[model samples]
Target chain A: MKPTNILFTCAGRRNYLINYFKEALNNEGLIIATDMSANAPALADADIAITVPSIYDENYISTIKDICLQHKVTAVISLNDLELPLLAKHKSNFNNIGVKVLISNEDVIDIAFDKWKFYQFLMKEKLTTPKTFIHIDEAIAETENNTLSYPLILKPRWGSSSIGIETVDTKEELILVHKLLLIKLKKTILYKASEKEINTAILIQEKIKGSEYGLDILNDFNGNYYGTFAREKLAMRSGETDKAISVITPEILAIGEKISLLLRHSGNLDCDIFIAENKIYILEFNPRFGGGYPFSHEAGINTAAIYIAWLKNEKIKASFNNYKSNITFAKCDRLLKIKSNS
Target chain B: MKPTNILFTCAGRRNYLINYFKEALNNEGLIIATDMSANAPALADADIAITVPSIYDENYISTIKDICLQHKVTAVISLNDLELPLLAKHKSNFNNIGVKVLISNEDVIDIAFDKWKFYQFLMKEKLTTPKTFIHIDEAIAETENNTLSYPLILKPRWGSSSIGIETVDTKEELILVHKLLLIKLKKTILYKASEKEINTAILIQEKIKGSEYGLDILNDFNGNYYGTFAREKLAMRSGETDKAISVITPEILAIGEKISLLLRHSGNLDCDIFIAENKIYILEFNPRFGGGYPFSHEAGINTAAIYIAWLKNEKIKASFNNYKSNITFAKCDRLLKIKSNS
Candidate 1:
């Protein structure tokens, strides 16, 4: 039998992803979703939905394994970035139980989960990125040397949801904002939430200007680059891309492929890229599906289908990037009716 | 030089088609549009808009020929079905002037332009079609023999815009509706308004039940079938499909290929198919882009690009019918901000 069972762990509000997978499955597979809350809208539409303990709970892994065994889930994935590290660290645990957890190896995930490490990794790949510095004195020296200047971004080293972030335009403002974030994030820095709290973990990088793009990079089960799609952000809402247009820039796709081949993340990898001054720059990486996936899918690139095919060991097209481009779309609020306490 | 100039003669309200052509050309070609009315929306967006005489005017052929010559147009095509027959009949007239008028041969145009002839051609092609009868006695005989019966559709032999048509349930209603259409159409039968008025043109066919489909079939410049795209009509308005979904039925595409190889119409040919009782049935055939071309194009099947490739002597994809299916779309009113009257 084919591996037709897909289980989404920590599937909080990703109903769109669930539906996309269901459509790709075309009723051939079962969608099993799990979250800490029974009221999560994303779980309402799944074939089987169960509430598991919180990610940090000591019994979380065993609870998920029990769910997988009960549902006969052959393929496993998660939408939560915090859950990825746990998934990766325990990938073998699931694999021993015949549940394939689609996540990258620990080394790749380490660089992805840290801003300074991601910067060094990109530099190693020979890809340009914004000049990033962890120490204020180093950044000030760069500014004095006229190599980089003010108008910099200060965010947590590996924070999710744009938490503890600040942008400054002048030297004094950069110093003040960096210090402010240093104290605020130290209160209880949730570095990916599921991991240990971090103190004095921050990233200050030069603010490059141009179009911002979100890429959905696909890889095989063995972390081999398959294809990549890029979308230029037209608007943003609450730190997430709201309106975007699919763009066909060879350099952007090339940069994504370079990163994928270097990092070797299995399955879908969410990546941030910058296009400025006629060149592409690499940015943050989230080793799972991000907010921009629906945009790619609507434009006719079915990453869900590609993922299922990879899981089934079926040969897919050489590149999922081959799609009709120039489509503009916006994210809209979708409500899923569910029982309040269910 | 390649055929870098495209001419749309008798263009009506198909502004979308014009824009699609402009995108495919990418500044490499010129789009020239013509219509009998200066207010034609499609012409308003073209690089060149010319008012041409009506098809029946004595100076019609000379006027189009002049437009082609003055604009240095290398390709000439029509959006009007009636113009297809005229263009096909006068193919050599355009060819002698060093212009390629993209239309099928006279035999194919004749069959496509006449419903009675289309029925006969389908029978010859061994394709399933709704049983049609022209004579009252023969229709009544079929009813008695239980071979066919009401509700029946009575319409003009080659009507465009569905001008003179009726659906009748009982035998009495069928006779009355048939008589009414016969008289009504005879008074001023604009069977495809761009052609000469026809008299005594009426058709009665069995109303097959099931979903209706709009097909866009592609052919090479030399009149060989490439492939076809199918869209199932979900909702229709004013004799046009307003909402539709891309459907992948291999038998339907195979039948289209079979018909195309037999008829060999160059470029885009819009044909209607009905899925009744789990069997595909051929309906009306329009030898030009119909209302459903946009739906097909949006689904990543680029007939405009395919057409340009064929014109430029480029080998297109092996088959146009190979596309991702199950995409649903709905058409809405779009406002074109044009001058009040220009």
Candidate 2:
């Protein structure tokens, strides 16, 4: 077996994932973690913790490349959503150094990161999605034309998790929240959104009331479709799945297969969908292990183990993807301590 | 079928549960909600939104009693964990008024609400639990003796959610957080805990590291033993289950059976257990529909509907408690907009 040396970029609070991978490596390899903060709890749990510059820093990629070379990293995985595009754009550079960056292609990552483009991608595939407007005036016009309803969802065009999301039931609340988002984004140190792609700070979409589902769609390195595992969201907090149960609904699986074939992502593709009025609607896409992946992992899907097996050119058991249904789980806060050497 | 008028006391954000009961009644019954805030989103979804005094107010129970009598409420349910004891104490008063308050016995509620008592109960039952200490000196000594490890969990003797929870790896951090919790508790509006019961602001418990599971143990009014449905926690936010997958492990289920027999809680009993080193450790218990109930509900355990049926003296199907395994679920934020009748 090729010795596995995995590197996690922007490892914030995902100490659990790092530990899981560490266990998967079975002490055969080391797990290296990098974050901008030396105090990031997850970094302390890694075999090697390196504090690096932030994602937007010009030295970010070079710093990671150097880490990869220094540590002989065989795989590079990023925990932050914003880092995916950059990693995908520089996949070849890492590949030249014999490092495999676990990310989708540039087009896929671009569509996944940009909300407007994601909505268009879904619409182009003739899939149902909430009607989204990139401009405030167009959103207002659509609302006036009775094409949209009250209790609209306004969010940053380029956002992760549920930050900057506001639900406005009236045009007044919409106008106020829209303006507030712009002001907030201008001052938001975390948001790296641009004003050019979006006419303002956020995109307005009709809030579809329905049961939500989180899916982990699998694809082989050759972009071949595997099955999809879905969990109906029972409770959510901070835009993460708080409580959910794995389900084997054929329709949802079919939708996953359709999207997988269309997007052609070569690994774990996290997707959000809503079932409103008995019709499935595609909501959002993140081409990485979402905060909800642990659900699939715990339900016997073993995506992490499967990824490792696939990378090692080992024959994977088909049963790995066939997770059992009705398995429910919840998460709680955990503490990770790192002793300071300085 | 007897017409049902359900009253949810201290209804915060459980619009989904209210709507579930509403659909179960099929518009033949009314849903009334009471809270300290008229702006409570769940209250707006109710047929009648009555603003009630705080739990400590002298007229609180009387106000709820009057609402029960006026609305001819068939059932009284509480969403807040703190309110469980209050409701259980006055269950007979509601009973005299021909209203059923869905709560366990006052003893069960007392043990569930008090962390120190819960630890004692678990110890007396010979069950695994994190070693807990009420005094800081004893906690420190335990660490010194190596009976308890570092990375202790410090929180108010009586707290809910993830609030006031501080995990400290060092003795200094533990002491600091303990003092801070006391100061914070003196300012918290929700906690009506008596100062006489707590010598310190916080109870120190050994932080047991492992996979956590949330179980909804169902029982009859007589507190008879029934099966439990459990979900392993995948992720957590703000102390609530964010993502979960359901599993029917026999050992975990047997632990639920044992606890159910010991506690003898009627109706819904929510418990948290951690599997550390193959030992199941009982963490906490809440004798009400916990935030994780949606996972069980969506997994086809219709505990709400079953509770309603059990109260109505109707025969319940045995299969309601036997939910299937491996179903995964997550929670998402939904807008519950209530138009002001004013």
Candidate 3:
């Protein structure tokens, strides 16, 4: 069997993914994990854990490349949203070193990472999404014109993982929180990403109250369409799905297929969709693995094994497609011992 | 071995504790967990998962008593701060039915649950703690008098977990946030707790800059001091210790002994301490099993087993005290499959 060492970058707390990949390797190859913080919990579970410079550091990419060359990493996967565009933009650098980066193209990353762009893409593609306004004036004007309503969500345009998210119940609160959020955004890590559109950094989105679903849209290395795994979010905490149950519906499956075919992204595409007013609205989509991927894995869709098989040029196993519906799972905390900084 | 069926009330997400107790029982007893929500992750880990009414409901105490009787529970423990006083106040109700509720006395619960009372207790006991002012006028006056400084923490006077906590850099921000916090506190479940002291429900505290430590002070069922296990917090997330390494210090041990002897808190007393400016300060204490218990457990302290032995009236095992220093652990998320609502 061809060695299938996997390198996970920006691996903050996805210890489950590291172990999954390790199991898939089955002692044939090693699992390498990297993060800016040496103490990131995921690092403790990897066969090899390396601490790299911050993604914004000048030597960050070079540090990653050095690790890749030294370890003979077969494929690199990023578990962070902010690092997705960086890896996608520098995919050729790894390719030149005979290392595969399992990231979508830069165009795909841009369309998925930028919330404003995501809204525009949804509009252009005739996909339903919440009404989003980039400017406070525009949002207030829409509210005045009766196009937008109260209880709007104010968040960073380039947000990840629930930073600086606020719900404004009234116009007064919206106006006040909008200013406060913009100020807070500048002090956050997202400021660097939002610097390009500092004026439109904050997004005022209509709040949709309904059931939320997380979709894992799989595609081949060639970006060919694969089956989708859907989970209805039963509970949410800290902006991530806390509890969810596997779901299979024609409407959700059809939408997932449409997104997969349109995006044609490699590996897994994690999409957040909300159903309200009997319409499916795409809240956002991350091209890489997301916090909700564990739910899909627990439901029997073994994407980690599939990724390894594809890397080894083996036929995809039918066993991986044994995903069943109504399988519920909730995220719980487990303790991991880290190497003491003695 | 007596069937020591354990019932954990308000068991929201302490799956680790549930499993720990289960392991200690060694299949000789059952772990019963209850929560207001049917989908609580901790409940799924327990042998008997139960959905109970909200703690504020009129029948809350009766429901718990009924569960204890139905499960033939030998011991009852609670995993929530707000529920601590409720359980403590009704200790005799459970005791009358021969269920040993593993909770502190009402006086200890009152001191720990009320942050203002906790601060006063620290002051009275000649223990060092952050200077706190419950009134906005007094806080502003203290700043103006040069007795206090900028960058203060404004939080609910009766705060549990990380709810309604804010930090203000300047006097202006402090004044603003204090008002905002008061308004926000009323909107939270804490409103019921803070209702009696609505006028002084917000506390402006000095922000201590230093290394934080979580100390688990173990006391037996009879409220006799057992030992103190301290862990220097390496990181914090959502107001709980994320990473910590066990540490042994004469000073910390002395403080733990003093507090344990004075408070005589039953079960585990989780205390938050800070070392800053070459002085040790007690930040707050929760008189129950805390999030940091797992770190102590992984460090070789078998408090779960100890509790079981105590309940069984067995001779205290010396092996249960085999704790060492310099052990570090970080919390990571694990998936728990929950029974579907269907």
Candidate 4:
């Protein structure tokens, strides 16, 4: 049998994923992990760890391609929100070298990474979403018209990290925070991405107070809908799912199917949704593995093994349908010894 | 030998401690963990888990004493800053039932839990510390007199969590943030603790920018200095150490020894310090097991095993003196399954 070597890019701290892939490989393949920093915890768990240039570096793509060629990588997976769009834009480069990059197309990635675009995409698809405004004047006009109220959320349009968020309870506080956030945006790593649309880089969102749910939409390598695993977030810490329970229902399944048909994102798409007053409101989506994936994996689904089977061109429809609901999990910290000079 | 069962109170997320004690016991004892919430991740790892009332409740101390008597608890260790003072206050109650609570005296806990008291204690001991002021007027005067500078830190004097922190770069920002922080203090869990000093609940201080280091100052069950393990923090995330490398130097060792001798804290005391221009400045200390304990444990110092030996009344000094320097470790997330009715 031919080996199905996998390359994980931007593998910052997803040590669980690296271990999962290694377990599924089962001596059949190698797991190579790369990140900008050599001291990333996940690197220590990989079979082969490499430190690569930053995703924004001019020769970053070539550096990745060189690693793929030298290691005979069969597939490439990215584990970062900021690096997904880069891989999507250069998907053909890896494909031309006989390596499949598991990323969505450029349009799908843009809709997922940019908050304004995501809101517009949800509206156009007739999906429920909170009212979002890109212009401060428009948001203020809505407030004055009594159509919108206070307790609004302000966040960067192109932000992936949970920082740079402000909740304003009054109009005066909203204006002050809006000004402060604009200045703060210029000092963040998101500044480079927001430079082109600097004027409309901040989004004024209506804060939704309801139960939050996360969905992991899975598609085959051919971009065909496979399954959607949903989990209700019970607790949150540091902007990640600290505790969650698997929840499956017809409403959530239908929405997942609809998004899968509309977006057709390859592999995994981590999504956020809010349920308030029996209505489901789509929040945002990411076109790659997210922090919430571990919850879904521990519940029942073994996407890592499924991906391995797909890479080996084996029939996986019957073997991979083992997802169950009502399982719960909580995240805890573990220490990983790292090589000082790695 | 009689069973040396240990009970960890407020065992929120310190799963490593639970596992370590279990391993060290190796069937000679049982590890019991208790928290207000049944869903605390650490509880799932213990041999026996219990849910108790809040530490502020009148029945809280009695509840803990009942558990000790029933389980034949040999030692009691706390993993929370807020609970250390409570445990110390009621240490005699547990001792009357033949349970040894691994906690410092009320005076030591008070100095560790309150930032203002910690500063005063440091000054009294002639230890190097940052200039701290409990009043905004005094801080402003210092800044005006050119004794202090901009980029100051404002935080709750009685805060255990790292949420309510603000860094101000100018006079206007400092004044505005101070007002906001005071208002915020009332809405946090620390409000109850800060009620007596509500008017002066906030602290303004010089923000030190330098290499941060964490030390695990160990004292035996008799409150005698045993050893000091120091690690240089390489990175921080969400106010916790993310990556660190062990560093044993004469300067750091001396500081640790001095604090241990002066405070005489029981078991483990997590201390934070900073070095700038070859000057060591003590930040603050917590008289309980902290998030940084795992780094020290994995680096070579088996404090968990040491605690077990101390509980068993076995010789531990010669066995635990194997700590080495230059070892590095990083914190990562691991998922633990939870029972729905837990």
Best by DockQ: 3
**Residue-by-residue lDDT tens digits, candidate 3, A1-342:** 666778999898899999888887789999999998888999999999999999989999999999989998999999988888888889988999999999899889999878899899989999999999998999899889998898899888884834547777777677666665655566664536687778898889999999999999999888998889999998877677899999999999899889988898988999999999889989999898888999999999999999988899888889877899999999999999888666
User: Tens digit of lDDT per residue, candidate 4, span A1-342?
Assistant: 778899999999999999989988898999999999999999999999999999889999999999999999999999988888888889997899899998899999989888998998889889999999999999999999999988899888984854547777777667766765666566564436688888898899998999999999999877899889999998887778999999999999999989999998899899999999999999989888889998988887889999998888887756556778999899998988998784
lDDT of 4 at A269: 91
The CAPRI classification for model 2 reads as: incorrect
The top-ranked prediction according to TM-score is: 3
Model 4 docking category? medium
TM-score for candidate 1: 0.49
- Sort every candidate by lDDT, greatest first: 3, 4, 2, 1
lDDT of 1 at A265: 81
Model 4 chain B: lowest-lDDT 10 consecutive positions:
B182-191
Worst 10 residues of 1 chain A by lDDT: A333-342
Q: What is the TM-score of chain A in candidate 1?
A: 0.93
Tens digits of lDDT, candidate 4, B1-342: 788899999998889989988987889999999999878999999999999999878999899999998998999998888888778888897888788999899998889888998898888888899899999999999999999998899888994854457777878777777765665566564536688888788889898889999999999877899889989998887777999999899999988999989988888999999999899999989888778888888878888788988877788766566778999999999999887783
Better of 1 and 2 by lDDT: 2
Off by over 4 Å in 2: A189-193, B1-342
- Please estimate how well model 2 matches the true structure, expressed as its whole-model Cα lDDT: 0.79
